[model samples]
Every structure is written in structure tokens, then in C-alpha cells.
Target: MAELRGTNPYHIKPPEPKVLPKNYTQGVDNLSSEDFLKIYIETLRYQDPFQPQDLSKMLEDMTRLNQIRYMNDMKSFMEGLKGWFNQITLLSSLSLIDKEFVFSTNKIDTLKGGQYYLLSSEDIKGATIRIMDGDDVIKEYQVDINKGLNPIELSDLPKGHYSVQILKNGMPVDSLNLGVMGKIKSVSVSGGELLFELENGELVSPSRLIYAGGM
Candidate 1:
């Protein structure tokens, strides 16, 4: 057994008592303007008269709090308005389902070849319509065009995707453009984007569409 030595009172100092900060406004983070005003009034009533609270600083804080609340309210209102607009857009898009819509493109896909149209600004005689399969030209037609829509028969071509081009005197025509017509099967939203499904099982954006109406 070891002999016990007497402890020095000065060496073993007692620990000081813990002092916690008194947070009077604790848990008031979500307080409304009215609630804050009530607290402010109560504080003024209970404060010691000799040691007055800082009136200017308190008023400034109150003004700042009001501004913050106003901004938060405006943010919520704007968000709700945006949601309403999106819902309206979706509702309008739903009307396009089962309707025919035409989109502008130079490409076409067909299971069995179908009829397509070419629009010319002026009368173009002996303009060449070239149907391309990759870099290879599968078919070519020398045809005369009117100033309006000219019907082209693609029923003779094979079933696949092809690029269509109109050329005049071996130079590409500028005024001529191609439009592909399809029926809308459905409309949907994905990742906040609007999408339209076609009868051919293809998904397209509404911005690409130039025309939508009954078949």
C-alpha cells in the first residue's frame, strides 16, 4: 500500500461555474411581423427606465425584418404564378393529342414510303430533288415546281430514314424547305421539359412544330 500525501488547497483549484449566454430571442427565427412587434412592445414595457434600450437600432432592425418578410412573400407569390403558367401550358398542349402537327426538318423516316411536300417561292423548272441515303444518292428526280406546295411521291423508295434536298442548276435552292407531317399520340413532361410523342413513336419538341390542326 502506498502512503497518501496531503493535497495542497491552492494547487487543486475548484472549477468555475459554467456561464451560458442568455438568448432572449431564442427560437424566434420564424416569427412574423406582428409577433415581432408584440415582443418589441413587451420588451419596451419591461426594460429598466434608467438604462433605456437603443430606440434607433431597434427601429432599424424592425425595418430590416419587414423588408425580409416582404421579399419572402413576393418570392412565394412568383413561384406560385410560375406553377400556374406551367399548368396552363400543359393543359393547352394536351389539346394537341390525336391532332395532326407539321414540323420543319430536312429528314424523313418511313416504314412504308409516304407522300411529302415541297414548298417553292417561285416557279422552278427542272429543279432536281435528291433523296440521300448517307453520302450516297439513292434516287433523283428532275421536276418542275409551282410557287406553292408541290407534292412528291416517295412511295417508290425503300423503308428507312433519308435526307431530302432540292437543287437548281446543281446549286442548292435557298427558298425551298421541307415539312414532315405526323399525328400527335401523346404529350408529356420530363425534367421540366415538354415533349410530344408522335404516331411513329418519335419524341419531338413543340418549338419545332410549325402547324397543328385536325387531320
Candidate 2:
């Protein structure tokens, strides 16, 4: 049996109690101005009769209260403005789900089927536009690829989803989704950002959009 070197039964110090802030106007339903006036009246009633109270300090307290209330009002106004702006933004995003979109993408969609524009980000000629399904190439088109909108006459192209692959010198340089002309599938908020989910299972930002009402 080992003997304890040091042992004290009642040597521990008691912890100090935490002090909370005093609510000066504790359950009163009156506003700040009313409460301040009530306190001022009570102070004057019981103040020292001989030693005059500082009227300047009381005026300063009232001024401070007004300033605090003004600031609170302005803060509420700014919050309302921000909420209105968010509502406008969300409404604009919702509109995209109905209108057709013409943006630079590889996934080409033809909802109405009249004409689909194929655009290139790079200036390269002799790039074969190969229509692809999965990894297999379905059809190829020989056209002088330019760095701007190149229209593909969609006379009878079936309304569906298709992918476009651009090849340079018989070698794959870039595979892009063909331009889409269809309504966005849905609009949702993810991670505090508005996302437009297209019919091709693509998520796009509404800010970078080009609207084409129809094919």
C-alpha cells in the first residue's frame, strides 16, 4: 500500500459567479423614447435638492438615444432593399427556365428545330465537326470553322440532345457540347448561388446567358 504524498480535504477555491448584464427597463413594453422620459422624470423627482443635476448630460443621453434609433431604422431599411434585390434576381433566373438559351456549349439541343448555331471559341479552319453519340462518331461535317457563330440549317434535325466533337487535322482537339435552343429544365439555389439545370443535365449560371426565344 503506497502512502499519498500530499492530500487536502478542503483546500479548493470556490469559483466566482458570472454576472449578467442588467436590463434597465426590464419588462416594460414602452419604446426607448418613453423609457428614457420615464427614467428622466424619476431622476428629477429624487435627485439632490441643493446640488443641481447636469442638464447637459441628460440632453446628451437623449441625443444618443435618437442616434441609436435612427441607425436601427436605417439598418432595417437596407435589409429590406437587399431582400427586394434578391427577389428580382430570383425572378430573372426563373424566367430562364422558360426561354430558349443560346450559349457556347458542346451539348446541342433543338427544342423547336428550325436552325441551330454552332459557335467556336478558337479561330481554326478545316476543323471537322463530328456529331458523336457517346464515344462513337455518328456523322461528320466539313465546314470552315470560324471564331464566331456558324449556323447549321436544322431543317429536319430531330428535337433531341446531341454532342459535337471538333477535330483538327484528323486529330481530336476539342470536344464541346453543341449549342442548345431549349428551355432550361429547372432553376434552383445551391450553396447560396442560383443554378439553372438544363435539359442536357447541365448546370449554368444565369448571368452568362444569351437568350433566343425560339429555334
Candidate 3:
């Protein structure tokens, strides 16, 4: 208005478009393959006649659905195989526990003679006892043991180092090697049972002993 020549006006910039995160839809699993196919077909039928959905985009969506189906099937098979392997391992461990076995010692103190007691569970049947002198049989005794705890006496045997063997029905059950002659130090209880402590500081259970003599 005041005779200004070519006055320029201020320009306004448009705001930027908002970017949304992917996977905005929920409840995708509720739709099955058949439902998806029906929806796609109907969209093609009723979509704007001039401006329709791109064929390439529709093909990509179908490919993604097939991949999801394959992944779900694979996951189910792997879960079943894991359960089977766990059962097999549990059965193997139980088999080892049910087998009968013996306990023995290696340290022989070169004792001439001593008294010892054998302890065993009441259910142990057909019990037999034997004394061995370095692969040579010294004496063998038949024992009639009742349930709970039974004691056997092995006296009058000259011993340097002897191995005691317990058998059931002619099969070897358990064995232990006695050290040199020593006196009883004390008796103690472990796991609710009595153990004989020898003067040599060796602790033995009555179950580990097959014979007790000259006490």
C-alpha cells in the first residue's frame, strides 16, 4: 500500500506423515486359511473397479501364510520328541538302583587277627559266608540269617590279611578285605546304624563285616 515493489509473503511448511509400527492388527490366529482365502476373493470382487489391489502384494501375503503353517507343524513334532527322550532316561536310572552289589576295602593293615560283625537287611536271603587268604580258600560257613540284623562268628582262623565274601544262592553278593590285627576303638552310629571303629582309625559297618570272632 505504501508503494512497495514486489513484496514477498511468508511460506508455511506441511507437517510430516506419521509412521506406525508393523503388526498393528490383533487376533490374527483367530482367522483360518479358508477365511483368508474368502476375504481375498471378496476384496477382488468388490474393490474399486478402476483402482484394484496389486497382484504382487496379494501373492506375497499368501506366501507368508504358508510359511507360518509349516513352522507350527515343526514345533509340535519337536515337543513330542523331547517328552519321549525324558521317559527313556528315567527308566535307565531306575534299573541301576535295583541291582544287588557288594562293598569292599583295599587298605590291609597286616593285622594277625580281630573280631568283626556282618550286618545285612532282613530281606537278604540264602546268605553264605566265606573267608579267603589271597586267592586261597581258608574257610566257608553257611549262615541262617533272619530279617533285620544277623551275626556270624569266625574264630580259630590264622589270618594275616583275609577277604570276607558274602554269597546268596551260590552267587557272590558282597566282600571286604580286613587290615592288620587291631583292637576296637569305639562304636558309632551313621545313617541310623552302628559302625565299628578299629584302633587303626578305620570305620566299618556291620553290613560290611561277614564274620566276628575272638571278641
Candidate 4:
């Protein structure tokens, strides 16, 4: 048999060693603490005898490096914690599905009709219930008010989202309190905020909900 002159295809070649310049320590953002220490040692070995490196500054740099590492580790831990919290929130909210909850809100989204209430401090005459679609008032109802919780009844308007405002004497009531009751259809998250989709089409935040109970 002829002597094997060609290189063997199955033979694996060793990777080349990485070489750094003498006393190299320029870019170190990606370097680990051990790698940085090795570079620091090399820097000290090749440092000029007439103009030695500043000991205090070197110590400060090492301290800063360790601090950066610590901060990075903390950031990773926080990210994991946030993920865990979101999962918990999602799991917890699933239990509220099909359960009735009384939440506070000023908006109504429904196909047929909607139910809401106004928490009035005092009875006032000639108050207007202004249903707003964007900036325009789509519907209005003139009615007298009563102290405590006053029920608001809305007819089946077109299927859409609308904002409800109580106006007294043509000015918006600044201290208006509006609330609604609906069964939870679904639960979701948006921008890290927990949200509940009501059976009547309202999207409410958990922070806004004041009461929860069965239908």
C-alpha cells in the first residue's frame, strides 16, 4: 500500500490560541473578571519602571469591574423575577374567569346594553350623561341625580367602545365616580399590567376593580 501522503479528512485540527499584545488592556467590556486579572497582570509586568502604573487607580478600576459584574448579575436576577411574577399573575387571574366582578371604570363596551353606576356626593338638578366617542359626544341623557350610588342605564347603542362622562351645567364633573359590574370573560396582560376582559366587552385593570363575587 502507498504511504498516506494526503491529509486525513477525519482528523480534527486544534484551534489556534488567542494572542494579546504585551500589556494589552483596551477593550474589556466583554472580558470576565479572571480574563481582566490576567490582562492586568500582563500590564503590570510590561509597565515602564520609570513611570509605573498608579496603584490606587488600578485598584479603583478593579473595584469598578467587580461592581459592574455584580450589577449584571443583579439585572439577570431581576429579569428572572419579573418573568416569574408575570406567570403567577396569569395563573392567578385564570381563576376569575366566568366569575362576576364589580370594577370601577368610566368606559362602556357592549353589543346590546351596559350597566353602570355613579357615586354622587350630593343630588344635583339637570345633570347630563354624556356618552363620548373620542372627543365628540355621541349620546346624551338629561336626568336628575341622587345622593349615594345612582344607577345608569344605557340603551343598546352601536357596538363600539365609548367613554361616559357626567356633566353638570355643561361642565364635566371633576369628582365623577363611575363603576360597573360584569363577569370576567378573559384575563390578559398588557405592558406588564394585568387586565380583565369583561363579558360585556369592557377591559379593566385589576387596580380599578373594587369588588369581586359570583354572578
- Clashes per prediction? 0, 6, 10, 0
Clashing pairs in 3: 109-179, 109-180, 110-180, 111-180, 111-181, 118-209, 119-206, 119-207, 122-147, 122-148
Residues 60-150, model 2: lDDT tens digits? 6666776676576667766665555554566656656656777655565565343456656667777787666678666677777666566
- Give the local distance difference test score of model 4: 0.73
Candidate 4's residue-wise lDDT over 1-215, tens digit each? 97777433334333333355676554354577898678778978999989988867876776688677767776776666665566677776787899876678757766435577776778878999988899997888898887666777677567788888888888888666777777889998787778889886768888887654332
lDDT of 1 by residue, 103-144 (tens): 677776676344567766799999999899998897898999
lDDT of 2: 0.62
lDDT of 3 by residue, 23-60 (tens): 43332444677987898899889889889878677656
Those runs of model 4 whose alpha carbons end farther than 4 Å from true positions after fitting are: 1-44, 108-112, 121-149, 156-172, 189-191, 200-203, 211-215
Stretches of candidate 1 off by over 4 Å are: 1-78, 111-115, 212-215
Q: Give lDDT: candidate 1, residue 97.
A: 88
lDDT of each: 0.73, 0.62, 0.53, 0.73
TM-score on alpha carbons, each prediction:
0.58, 0.42, 0.32, 0.57
TM-score of 3: 0.32
Clashing pairs in 2: 105-177, 106-176, 106-177, 106-178, 107-177, 107-178
Comparison by lDDT, 1 against 3, better one: 1
